[model samples]
Target: MSRTAWRWSRRPSAPSSPRSRPFRSKPGTWRRCSGANAVMSCRSPAGRRRHRPPEEATMQPEPITCRLIVEAVAEFYGLSIVDLLSHRRPQRVTRARQVAMWAAKRLTTRSLTDIGRFVGGRDHATVSHAVRVVDELRERDADFRQQTDDVVLAVEATARTLARFHANGPEDVDPVAVARRILATPRGVPIVSIPEITALASAVSAQELTDSSKMMTGPMKRFRSEPRDRESEFDLYRAVAEVLEADRALKQAQWTHGERGAQARLDRGLKALRETFERETEHVD
Candidate 1:
């Protein structure tokens, strides 16, 4: 018998079976896979599982409810809902309460009637009245408008954060201080105006350029030989004009000469002018 060489060929190994199929993820971690199936599994500490896609999170929370809104408004303004809902007409308290009611209406989704009931059991009409009053006041009073705006913004921001928490999400919002800073700029005031700029420039120039000659001149000297009871209006006017002219001349001389020369000339001129005026005025009196 001839012995023929026999070769053994290795066949492909059988495919391994998947022991455990992909598991379902928790409520927030569900994602679709290539197999067209939803997978729900968090990565293990041992790093055996594949990474999961992050879920889209909600931003801010829903606005505050009517009741909570009223409470927040009351707390911010230091007034009870009862006081706010009251029919009392005291100016300060009434104004504060009206502002609170107005804020509650604006910051919540509650119906007007519901908001009124939450705020001291007021009627819808009362709430409407309050809001109107506050609106009118805000139009007229800058301080009141600013105060209301601050409280409303704070409450609304907090409400939004709470809403985000309820939705199991996070939101990025600018801080309240940033909003306040933006709003704090003075309203209805121009940043620059030609008339105002010109006026300011003129004032600055006047302050910088002061004539010093008049200050260096000696005081006017007056000599009256007799007491004058009354001087005519024309005579008074002429005397004043003469004194003013002498003063101008003294200043002009002072501007040109040294202090000693200016002083001597000013004194002599003032004395002679004073003597003449006094003598004439005494005769009239």
Candidate 2:
């Protein structure tokens, strides 16, 4: 043991500094902290204390205006206010008026009595009855149901645009021009008799015939008979016409072909046979 040279060796100690204190929040208190610079409280519930963003409040309902409701109804029914208020009870007009009454009651906050007064001073009971009638008709009739829905949506849109326009100022747009545009649009051709089709085309100011098409092709025959047998001849002609017209349009289009020419000759032969049937029917009649 060389005691004279022995000495104790010690490890160097870390430098001492003040420790940062942990945040302590009071019970039920929300911390006012922000972003990455935030310090969370140990007492807060959860994985991390995050302040939630404020939620948006619900929108308030707008006040319903009388003009909006009336205009909406008029535009939807494709009728003027004067006509709607008239006492006419035609099927289409009455149906449209009833629909207007129904829409006014539904879309506006006005009382039933108020709605009735606005709609040509009708009684509240009458308005109620009209609404009920339309409701029942919509359930029973497919066409009526579609018409009602289309009118309702159109009126609602018109009402909204009107509200905005009035709130701002009067609009410069011409309503008549808008109406003419709507009228100019073509609609689907409904399946109807040839006579009815001609009438409709005339009413719409459309051409009744074009160079590409001919009068509908149908069987035609002439038979000599006594004056009393005229009804039988007419009936025979009608029956033949029905058969020919009932054939597909494509088949009728091909009627000029050779095969159809032969069929036409055969059809003529059948008409000769019809002579006997006509004679028998004439005697029976």
Most accurate candidate by TM-score: 2
Q: Which ten residues in a row have the lowest lDDT in candidate 2?
A: 205-214
What is the alpha-carbon lDDT of model 2 when measured against the actual structure?
0.52
Q: What is the lDDT of residue 125 in candidate 1?
A: 93
TM-score of every candidate relative to the true structure: 0.35, 0.36
The residue pairs that clash in candidate 2, if any, are: none
Summed backbone clashes in each candidate are 7, 0
Task: At residue 181, give the lDDT of candidate 2.
Answer: 54
Alpha-carbon error at 120 in model 2, in Å?
0.4
Q: Model 1 over residues 1-285: C-alpha lDDT tens digits?
A: 223322223445576656654665676443334223323454443446665445414354464665455556667776543334444455776776677678777865667776655554468998899899999989999998898998888777767666645642222122232334545775744354443343343233222211112221222222233344455444544555655565455445543656456446545555555565555545443
lDDT of 2 by residue, 1-285 (tens): 455434323445566554655566775455334322343322334446555322212322234444445545666666544446545565776887788788777777777777666555568898999989999998999998998788767765554554544443112122233435546765943344443332232222111111001222211211233243666656655655543443233234442655455445434544543564445444443
Residue ranges of candidate 2 with Cα displaced over 4 Å: 1-66, 163-285
Give per-residue lDDT, candidate 2, residue 127. Answer: 92
Model 2 lDDT, residue 145, Cα = 91
